[model samples]
Target: MLTNTVTMTTVEIAELTGKAHKNVLADARKVIEMIGGLKSQPSSLGYSEATYTNKQNKEHPMLVLDKHLTFTLITGYDTGLRHNVVGRWIELEQVANPAFAAQAITETLNELQARVNAMAPAYDEHVRKGRTVGYSWREACRLADIDHPDKLLAVLVSLGRARKTTQGHTQLHPDYERDGFIKTLKPSNLVVSKNGGHLFKITSKGLTEWLKAKAEEMNTAVAFAGVDRWGRPIK
Candidate 1:
């Protein structure tokens, strides 16, 4: 039997991440694509998580984890990211210096996550409530500074970073036209519109999905996916 095609909308991922979905998903997806393709697991975190709060003692890191970077790590793990060094070229000093290997991997991971967040869809909902003329792949690529915004945007939307307008020219938004691509990304459900051509709100279900995205981070301290929401080890 022929399989039916599937597509994801920003509303779906916003629903997935439990945040205001809409244009945000598009923005996130664009930035992520601009950064480059996705990765499942990265080897490292280049920069340290900054102390986020400016208050006498604020919570969270100052250098917020770039959403795109998180997506890179997730996609990278699924794909294979080999170390650049040729085994023969590895030196004795490199072996002795643990920091060398650690730093390289960290940089890779940080890059991945940083890009994902940058491209995540976070559009102006009040402006574009429903669909309009639709976005051209080339135009999007240009705006986002991505070489292949078409492909990258599709990935981000499918993965829940951003979404596409369902009622537009599928040709412009290739994600709607692609069959297996959507199936592979497998978005959970639903898309929405607040006004003209912007905004996607996360559904109640998306809240849980965004929560699961927490699992996407690369492990810097030897723990796989490291630390549950409660700060407890996965064991």
Candidate 2:
């Protein structure tokens, strides 16, 4: 297949820069408004409508940006993020010119894939040896910044967001379940050891979900302060 230039949406920008999607959208709107005022209208240097399928498997409208607009939006970010965005743009540019960059791109991708494939057998061996490899419960809690693992585990179990082994050990629910919050751990990647019991492996996806959930919880607490669930004032 012939390679083409890759465009990014505001959602992707937010994820890359660790900004809220809404905030990125707001910034993009401001840019659009500013460009609208210019006499020499750079019609091609603005966002376009796009759709992104979120973790919920629901598609939503979003704004996509070409290289020009992506750089424009990145300018409003902090120095550190600005540098990272520039680096990412460089990567995009290289891939966008595959005719000139084919050899370098192919070698880089092959090396990365080879490394990943090389680890597969070790992961399989760990499973066969009955060793549960991956992030442990404590590691997950640390990643999520949750101080109370027991409480969180109970909540996850109650909500069917977690699984219990035959030995009554809690594991991150598999991703096969559409409604599951975390999809990082797979059955092949998990093992039940006689000594360690059942181990739940945490994944980057699970960590991201955990952080998002925590953020939502904090937002809810702030929004619902001094108000009852029925929206009545707590007087």
Judge candidate 1 at residue 21 and give its lDDT.
35
Off by over 4 Å in 1: 1-122, 125-131, 143-235
TM-score of candidate 2 against the unseen true structure = 0.38
Candidate 1 lDDT for residue 73: 26
TM values, all candidates: 0.19, 0.38
**Most lDDT-accurate candidate:** 2
Tens-digit per-residue lDDT, 1-235, candidate 2: 3367667788878888998888888778656544441225444565577788889999877788876677666655655665556556547757776553657665754553454445446544533322233455555555455555555666666667666777566565565224333333333443445313335554444444444346446334444554778998787
The local lDDT score (0 to 100) that residue 62 gets in candidate 1 is 23
lDDT of each: 0.33, 0.57
lDDT of 1 by residue, 1-235 (tens): 1133222233333333444533434444433433432334322322122333334774432222232243432232212221221111123224554445756646655564454334333332211321333233333334333444344435555555456546531221233234211111112222212122223222212212221122223112224233677878866
In candidate 2, stretches whose alpha carbon ends up further than 4 angstroms from where it belongs are 1-6, 37-43, 99-235
Residue 201, model 2: Cα distance from true site in angstroms? 57
